[model samples]
Target: MIYLDYVSTTPLNQEVNHMYQSLLNDYFANADSLYSLGLKTSALMEKSRELTAQLLHVLPEEIIFTSGASESNSAAIKGCAFQYQNRGKHIITTAVEHSSVYQSCIQLRDVFGFEVDFISVDASGNLDLKQLEEAIRPDTILITMMYVNNEVGMVFPIEKVYQMIQKINPKIKLHVDMVQALGKMPIDLTHVDLASFSAHKIYGLKGSGVLYKKTSTSLVPLINGGQQEHQLRGGTSNTATHTMFAKTLRLALENLEQKYQYVTSLNHYIREQLTQIPDIVINTPSEHVSPYILNFSCVGYKPEVILHALEMYECYVSTKSTCSSHKSDISRTLQAMGIREDIAKSAIRISFSHHTTQDELDEFLFYLKKTLKTIKKQR
Candidate 1:
């Protein structure tokens, strides 16, 4: 099948796979053990952490390893909210964030009586800075938003937003869910205080993730056990997974420019092809969106209809975030962008990777055109 869902997860790269296997064989000892083998494993884990921090342009102590983006996000959001509950009970975020974030705010409100203000978005899924500024108040203690939206591929103006929030309330901690943007965009944590990223999104093993907390900010640990990860997260370190995460991140950074160009070419080609059809509406903006993901509505067609049609053509895609793929609710991102409900229901995401070839795009365009035609006929 043609895999067009890199936004969900990417396959492990050969180099990362080799590192994972090698580390599993040689560094199986617990990183916290006092034995010689354990000490060696601990050293390797620390080295990986240091390498990851260097890539993120932060100190090694700032990187906290977790199971995945979900865990890191949970730790960052809940950890900060709970830790600073006495200081404030209000938070700010966008309406188009992933379920891990949106749902965390919901739970925080219900469980802790914390108030959450959701900033609105425009038609291209861009958050309004004015709305965000108005949403902040003296009680607001945290502002968390995703760097790149998972489903719609819109890149938030994170640096500008961070600066704005810092100007208003320098003590208000800023957290970023950088899961989708880790490999696709540049991430320098010098400005962002708390950022979460996962390895599987960049062709590494699953269950390996990082949460960067700037030295100035402090958070309560969500997990209580061993002192691993600076006592922020518990459990013995998964040495192999950590090594593989570092390997994949290093490779992605080395090929960043090349991959960006490749994905941009693919997105442009697909946009060119879709424009000829005249029946589809590109939900994502051509100029401001990420090159790796494309979201659009198949006019006169529901997403389920087009999805079924594409499956017959052996082309795989998705309708929304993988975390909420099973839910039939209208995409919160599209809705927040002021898109009509009918168009939102018809919206689908076609995400690609640097490995995707031009020929693959040609074939996909052909099948997609055919599917659209079939969908039109049935309607």
Candidate 2:
């Protein structure tokens, strides 16, 4: 199968998989136990934390491992809101965030009585900085935004936004959902207060994730039980999976530049070929977007129909974020960008991994054109 849904999740790296298997067999003790085997497992888990912190340029104490990005996002947004609500009850975020971030904010608004200001994005899914600046009030205690848009792969100006927020209110916390940016780009945590990451996105184990909370930052425990994850999250540490994630992250960063160059070229090739197809409208902006994802609309065709047609040819693609793929509604990212409902409903997202080959892309393009022709004839 020609897998084009890397944004949803990546295949496990064989090396990382091997590490996971080895660790699971050797270090099966509970990390929190006081026994010798448990102590060794706990030490290994701390080592994994240190490695992840090194990658993000943060301290070992700042990295909190979780199930995945969804849990990390929930912990960052909800935990911060609950812990700092005494300081302020208002939070700011963008409209194009992942479902996890968006829903977390919604829960704060509906259940916790916090006021949320959702900034708008342009047609290309770029946030309006001016609106963001204007939305910050004295009661704005936190700002949650995504580093890279999942649907279109638009990279948000995170550093700039953080700096701007600091200038306006140094006390306000900034939380970034960096699930899509982890291995695809260089991540600097110098200005960020908090950020979330997922291991599966970088060819690591599915159950591992990371939340970077600056040393000075504070959050209420999402899962309260034991003293795991520096008291930010509670439960028995998934020692094996977290260790495997750190190894995968290190490997991914080692080849970051090389993979970027290769993927950029592949993206350009797809963009050029897609332009030649009639009724195809590229939704992803030519600039200010990650080379890993390309979202476009087939004017007369519905996304579900196109998805099934491509499936027949063993070309797997997607309509939107994998978390929201089961929903029949239009793309929230497209709607937030002010795209027409018809175009939004017809949008298809094609994401790439470093392992995707030129020949695979060529095959996909052939099937895509054939599918379009077949659909047209049926009409």
Model 1 TM-score is 0.96
The most accurate candidate by TM-score is: 2
Error of 2 at 252 (Å): 1.0
How well is each residue in 1-379 modelled by candidate 2, as lDDT tens digits? 9999999989888998887888989999999899999999988988988988887788999999899999999999999999899988999999898999999999999998999999999986779999999999999999999988999989999888988987899999999999998888999888888999999998888878998899899999889988888877777888898777678889889878899999999999999999999989999998889999999999878788889999998999998888998999987889999998777878999999888999999999999998998885323
* Alpha-carbon lDDT of model 1: 0.87
The global C-alpha lDDT for each of the candidates, from Candidate 1 onward, is 0.87, 0.90
Clashing pairs in 2: none
TM-score for candidate 2, please give it. Answer: 0.98
- How many backbone clashes does every candidate have? 0, 0
Give all TM-scores, in the order shown.
0.96, 0.98
